[model samples]
Target: DSFKSAAGSQTAKVQQVVTSPDGEKRYWFKLEGGQASPGMGDSPEPVDATITQDYETAAAMSKNELSGTAAYMSGKLRVSGDLMKLMQLQGALGQMPTALKGIDVDY
Candidate 1:
């Protein structure tokens, strides 16, 4: 609900890179028609924004122990491209906790 509302009519292709001792993992997702669909590896097409961060920072952000805005400001996270578009997806990203609640992560 919130995601859809916040997403509005926005459309974008976003890529994310998380680096850790295990190396780097990349993910791409598309926000279109008020829905977000994620995929592994690189994006099939060009992206509007790319966010890169360490695994710890990403984990912290996922657990709500840290905020994305703070991470970016503190140099823990890096983002490029249409930042405003990415920020607009903040509300959508906020739903991650609930959406990921049932999933079991190794770290």
Candidate 2:
């Protein structure tokens, strides 16, 4: 996936969660270059789970430089609604595309 910068620089895929439901648990996963669609938010329909985190922090966690549990303890990450659902979702999220490889961003 390509992430097009406002300045016209094309970056790698940076998955961003647009919305998530509260009860039903819905998640939207859009690759940077992928098309945007509606109904991305959480819904009443049952789903595995949903989690939202800062992109940079997620990258760090993905690399094992930080731990989700640790971040939560440090108040670096915030989770709402179902706590167990969030823990269960962690495994699946760790397998997704969390890093924007080869993409240069000004930190």
Candidate achieving the largest lDDT: 1
Off by over 4 Å in 1: none
Candidate 1's residue-wise lDDT over 39-77, tens digit each?
Answer: 999999999999999999988987878888899999999
Q: Best candidate, TM-score-wise?
A: 1
Over 5-89, each residue of candidate 2 has an lDDT whose tens digit, in order, gives: 2212211222223222333323344322333222445443443334456656655765657877787788666665556755644
Give the lowest summed-lDDT range of ten residues in model 1: 94-103
- How high is each candidate's TM-score? 0.86, 0.38
Give Cα-based local distance difference scores for all models. 0.85, 0.44
